[model samples]
Target: MFIPAIMAGGAGTRLWPLSRKEFPKQFLNLTSDQSMLQQTLARLEGTGHSNPILLASEKHRFLVAEQLRLSNVATSQIVLEPFGRNTAPAIAIATFMAASESPDNILLVLSADHNVADVAGFQKAILKAQALAENDYLVTFGIVPDTPETGYGYIKCGDPIDDNGQRVSAFVEKPDLATAQRYLDDGKHLWNSGMFMFKANVFLEELKKYQPDVFDYCQSAFNNMQSDHDFHRIPEDIFEKCPDISVDYAVMEQTASAAVVSLDVGWSDIGSWDALSKVLQKDENGNNLRGDAIALNTKNTLIFSENRLISTIGVQDLVIVETKDAVLVSHKDHVQDVKEVVSTLRKNDRNEADSHRQVYRPWGHYDSIDNGKRYQVKRIFVEPGAKLSVQMHHHRSEHWVVVSGTANVYCNGEKKLLTENQSVYIPIGAIHSLENPGKIPLEVIEVQSGSYLGEDDIERFEDRYGRVD
Candidate 1:
């Protein structure tokens, strides 16, 4: 039996503005109607694998659950990391969890934010890798390189192992243009795709052999794991001690059982805007435009606009991305440096680096429409049958005007049913909650007048989602 394990913890800061720390690229539908995470799950439809094991950070637990529900993908487990310790510990925890279910089960490890165009070809590679994995050989899929791309690390292929698989000659780091060209000329090198397959017990044994500290820490974390609803929470303090490293460094690079399977499928990590542009359809002027964008005299450029119309003229080899909260304009050649922008935002303690103007909650979402000194206006949406926590704010008083559907408002033990055009006032220090008791979504325009409007001002007496701050 084979089980899919998706590593979905990346912040994807390089695609900033569109991708943030709160909502990363993996949850965004950059390539299709389905999100990258959904696509990753959908591609395994015909692979006859068991339900997937999703590993995500605690902050993204709701996203993982909601996306999987939208995709109609059934997962065996949703493991939540208290904090990210990189791929090595993440995969180690997955391996331990899977092995507890079945030691013989093969684990097909995949990244959440990758685009694979040819599903058949990808499945074919998985079949070949499964064969090698069944024989206890650790397998990684190597993308057939079509260009001298310096952004990706290269893997040198050795003698043929079995089926189309080859023993890994060596794992090479990202090289200079000249060296990358030589590697392309060699014809034996492939792009390290970072996808892997191995039996659960085999991976655990190899991890224990090569990186015992990581394996031990991960095992302990898993052993002490707690389950809250569908989410599996690992012990935070123990997991934090696991070495911060990738699986490539701790195991694949040192394991003699490592093998590489060549994959010719159209694949991309979408690590940068330039990489994303290659996969999207281009216009007559060789421009990739998405979401209310128009370009004139633009060539080899990517323009993405959300919540606004973006028009560009006489631009070449550029990337312009606009979000509700931030805009990024960069030369295509320097798109890789977009992470530096995120770093600068972090250094300045900017909220745009972490969240969008619209913030998603477990119940639904809220959009900040306008804000000024001591006051803020927000449009909040509540899913049917969902309710906010029983809470109160110390410094802010709020007035909620229902715009659509029905709202059951509870303010300091007074329960009132409100409909369209109706309003309710929540005084400061009044324990209050809002619920959508109707069938359709509940939309409300909330106006807050306060001394402090920070989110940290909320004191939750009770929360259904078990959120505590």
Candidate 2:
């Protein structure tokens, strides 16, 4: 049996303003009603594998768990990386864990941020690749080049090993425009899809052979791994010592057992706005307008409006994305440079570079509605049976008015059960928490007044989701 190992912890900078460090493209509903991660889980149906081993960021544990819960995938295993050590270390860690259970079990590595339209085609490819992997061949799916895409690396097929498998000849880096066109014309080159399948022990052996330090460090890190509820946490100090590198650089390029399976399944990495446009439904003018967007004489344009109505007049070949906090207007031709803007934001220490207006928490979520010099307003949602940490903030006093459902408020040696339209006040430095006791969701409008209103003010004494470190 093969276990799906999903890599979901990427800071998608190219699709920025929409994709942030805190909530990346994998969790966002960019292409369909289901998010990219959910679509990936859905793609696994009928493949005889329902549960997946999830590799996610430490901060995104709640998001991953909640999404998986909603997706009805009950048997997922989440390994939280303290920080990204790139794909090499992440995959190594996963391999060690899977090998512990059964060395011969196959691992189907997938990127949670990728979109695959043809589920049947994708499943068929997985089975075909499984046959090669079972023969101890390290398999990588090579996407049949439909376009001359310079954004992706190319893999040239060597000689056919069988009817379904080919020996990977060359792992080529992203080429120039001319080189990309030539590769497309040659037909031997395929887009490196970054998906792979291999036996867990076989992957570890190849990794140890090519990158011994990575294998050793990850081995030690996995040996010292700790579990928190449904999540597995790695030792930060030891894990950080591992060299940060991509799997292609660490293993695929160096391994002699590397094999290629040319896949024609409709897949998109959604790395840029232009790539996302291909998956979306476009109108006759070649425009994909989502969420209250009106276009006049617009062609080959994609407009995504979140919480606002956007109108484009006589615009052609443009990509405009509007969010609650930031709006990105870029010509689709130069969307690749969006990462430059993200880099500048990181240099400036801007919050928009990492988070959105609506912030998710284990309890539920909170949307920052407004803020001033000394005050902030937020709409908070608490899931049923979920509670915020028993905590205190030194800098801010909060007054919450219940908008819907019911709330169980605990403050400073007292607990009060509050219903809809009721209110409560939490003074600065008061130990308090909010809980949803009803069957439905609990919504509250929280107004903060104090010298400082920041997320760091919370001092947790008790937390169910393990924030009490």
Candidate 3:
């Protein structure tokens, strides 16, 4: 049986403004209506695969589960990492979990944030890798490089092991432009796709030989794991003490059993804004415009407006993206440097580096509409039958006015039902919880007045979704 282990922990910083720390690009629908993570799961449909095992960060556990549920992909196990410890520990934990299914079960490792246009080709490649994996080779699918892409790392291919496999020579880091061109000209280099297939025991053996310390730490973590529903929580104290390193740096690059299988499926990692623009459809004038937008004389440009209209008269080879709180406008060639812009925002302690106006939670989401020194306004949307944690704030009082559906409100030990246009007030230090009692989503405008209005002021006493202290 093939157990797909989807890795969904990277915070894609290059696609900022639209992608944030709390919500990353993997959860964003970069192509079509489905998100990249959802697309990753959909790619495995009817491939004779079972429920997948997900390895994601604690911060994104709910989002991962929600997305998978929406995609109709029931996960077998959801392993939660206390912190981002890179792929070595992440894969180790996943490997240990896969072992419970069977000692010789094959794990098909895939990143949650990539797009592959040809799902059939991907499945075909997986079949080939599975055949090799059954023979104990640690096989990774390498994309046949279509261009001299300096952004992606390359894999040097050695002599053919069989008619369909080649021994991996070395994993090369991102090269300079000239070297990338040289790599393309050499005819022996392939882009490191990072997708792999390995027997559970084979991967564990390689880990033990190449990275014994990481193997030992993850072994201990797996032994101490606790399960809640479909979620598997790794022991935070010991897992946090594990080394922070990528899998390539820890074992894949050092193991002699590594093998590469060539894949020509249409693929993109979407590492930058420029990369995303390429995957989208363009107009007759070579422009990809999203949201409320009008353009004239634009050529090969990408413009996105989240909350307002964007008009461009003569923009060419540019990217103009706008959100409720931040806007990004840059030339296509310069989009890769957007990470430096994020660094600048971090240095200045800007909120744009972390989130947008809308904040997602386990139950629902809230979008800040207006704010001031002593008062703030937000539009909250609670999903049907969902409830917020029973909590109180130290310095803030809130007035909630229901806009749609029905709300079950708990305030100061009193429970009340509120319908459309009705309102309720929870005074400072009063425990409150809001629930969606109707079959549809409950929307409300929350107005807050307080000396301090930060989110950290909340004291949660009862929460269905287990959160950090």
lDDT (C-alpha, whole model) for all candidates: 0.93, 0.92, 0.90
lDDT for 91 (candidate 3)? 92
Every model: Cα RMSD to truth = 1.0, 1.1, 1.3
Model 1, range 10-62, lDDT digits (tens) per residue?
A: 99999998999999999999998989999999899888998889999999999
The estimated TM-scores of all candidates read: 0.98, 0.98, 0.98
* lDDT, residue 258, candidate 3: 92
After superposition, candidate 1 runs with Cα above 4 Å error: none
Residue-by-residue lDDT tens digits, candidate 3, 23-93: 99999988889998999999898888867889888889899989988998777599888888988899999
RMSD of 1: 1.0
lDDT for position 203 in model 1: 92
TM-score of 1: 0.98
The runs of at least 3 residues in candidate 2 whose Cα sits more than 4 Å from the true structure, single-residue gaps closed, are: none
Minimum summed lDDT over a 10-residue window in model 3 is located at: 460-469
lDDT per residue, candidate 2, 1-469, as tens digits? 6899999999897888999999999999998889889999988988887368999999999999988988989864799999999999999998898898899989999999998878888888898899999999999999998888888999999999998789999999999999999999999999999999999988998898889999999999999999978899999999989999999999999999999998887888988999999889999999999999999988999999999899999989999999999999999889999988988988999989889999999999999999999999999999999999999999999999999999999999899999989999999999999999899999999999999898998899999989998
TM-score of 3: 0.98
Residue pairs with backbone overlap in model 2: none
